[model samples]
Target: MKKETIKAGQITIDFLLEAADTNGAAAMFEFTVPAGAKTPLPHYHEHYDETIYGLSGVLTFTVDGKITDINPGETCFIPRGVVHGFDNLKQNDAKGLTIITPALLGPVFFREVADIVNQPGTPDLKKLGMVMAKHGLVPVVPKR
Candidate 1:
């Protein structure tokens, strides 16, 4: 199957399978975040669970305000409504597989984010916020 690719901030996301095809059961993707990349700000999903399985390099995750470092073969789960975010904190590349359960609107949000940031000008944060809201992705903290 052909994969959908998106550049969300400092990372490249390869959507292997979207939840749309799975009837909102799950969405899967492999993501590569460059060294020192700042990941998305802390946020929580109102209706879906998210999991990140480490595939390569180091990823520092902040889950519910607690920081933890994830290495290869490791996994972290963020239950629905739990605030969390992550970043590639090492000097090498960081890669992981992300899976969202009951994956309603995650793909749409990422696609929109890629489009907004890849354009020739400054991305519209207000527009992005609307998209998040539309998808039930509620950001508890401001983007850092």
Candidate 2:
């Protein structure tokens, strides 16, 4: 049981268990977002289903065309192919555990994002998006 911490933009990800270490069955990570932090753009995982369990504060999750407020101790799921994303909109920070099944791309995506953002200079948005695309994520256009 090895753990890794990765910084992606304004989020801190603690890899609890990687799918690769589990034969591609599942991956889990603890995510912490600071107050007023930025969030992943709206997107969908082409091959993995994600389940998120709130651990502290509040997080706003958007799936399909709906938005739900996830509070402490609550959980939600987004099936593969659903347009989804989340943000911490509360005055305090938010933390949660996210699990991805079928483990197709979760670990890779986090690693790439962390690498890109932790580099010497500013992170290239286009490059990050390309990396995400290669790992089976489709970024959705944000609503106006």
Tell me, by lDDT, which candidate is best: 2
Q: What C-alpha RMSD separates each model from the true structure?
A: 2.0, 1.7
What lDDT does candidate 1 reach at residue 116? Answer: 72
lDDT of 2 by residue, 1-144 (tens): 438887887899888887667798988898999999978889998888999999999999999989998999999999999999888888999999988897775656788888887777778889889998998898898968
Summing lDDT over every window of 10 consecutive residues in candidate 2, give the lowest-scoring window.
Answer: 102-111
Q: What does candidate 1's lDDT look like per residue over 31-95, in tens digits? A: 99999986776789998898999999998989888898889999999999989988887999999
Q: Global CA lDDT of candidate 1, please?
A: 0.84
Q: Clashing residue pairs, candidate 2?
A: none
Whole-structure CA lDDT of model 2: 0.87
Model 1 error, position 68 (Å):
1.1
Residue 22 lDDT, candidate 1, scale 0-100: 85
Model 2: per-residue Cα lDDT at residue 66 = 96
- The CA lDDT at 112 in model 2 is 86
